[model samples]
Target: MMLDADQRRTFAALADVLIPASGPMPSATAAGVPDALLDQALGYRPDLAELFAEAVARCTGKDPEAALDTLAAQQPEQFQALTLLTAGAYFLSPRTKAALAYDPPPRSALDDVDSYIDMLSTVVDRGFAIR
Candidate 1:
């Protein structure tokens, strides 16, 4: 689901407040939190789409910081949705990832079953103690 222009502006404004530039880090907007990255983030978390949309709509035309404060205080669920999506999207940017020195873990699974065999055997020895 694409955000409308106003929603995009509002989201950008709010995201900047939530994740302003830090020492070595860029702000949310600089990291593309409200642009293509946002779409990618929503794609990763489709379950949060509705809540995120509602959050943007609710904050539209309001002062970004004040709106965030209100949402955090009086509408915690929406606030959580907004912050999660914003941060999620911010991290999706290559620039952001590089700035944070993020390294994605290997996709291949390691077969470590043998490493825990002794623990498994102990559990088996205990047997099933049904209450």
Candidate 2:
């Protein structure tokens, strides 16, 4: 997933908070749980993996879980921004409009989130540092 095992739960909690299901779509937590996606990205998208890793390292130093907690505590705004960034990545995927098994809300069959996530993921995967 996007986070390590321990980080998974924390990330999930954060995801749920940051991008909750509103009316018709799943929360970013469910939508962006990147087990396979993360694996693929880490292996295939070296740039993204490195960029994201840098962020993790900056926060946690080594532990992904600690990184998230630290990021939230030390840099709440950055943490929130990261959460939205991840959500955007998942939203931009082609499956946004596709029916989900456990659909949430706020979003309907608009295929909007899919696109958002896809684009966001691409932008950050390359490890672009935003100042």
lDDT by candidate, in order shown: 0.90, 0.56
Please write out the lDDT profile of model 2 over residues 1-131, one tens digit for every residue: 25567555544555555566766676655565444434443454444554454444465424545667787788665665555456555554444445344456675655678889998998888897768
TM-score list, all predictions: 0.84, 0.42
Question: Over 4 Å off in model 2, which ranges?
Answer: 38-73, 92-95, 99-131
Instruction: Kindly give the stretch of ten consecutive residues in candidate 1 with the minimal lDDT sum.
Output: 102-111
Please provide, for model 1 over 76-95, each residue's C-alpha lDDT reduced to its tens digit, 9 standing for 90 to 100: 88899899999888878888
Worst 10 residues of 2 by lDDT: 33-42
Clashes of each: 0, 27
The Cα error of candidate 2 at residue 107, in Å, is 25
Error of 1 at 30 (Å): 0.5
What's the distance in Å from true for residue 128, model 1?
4.8
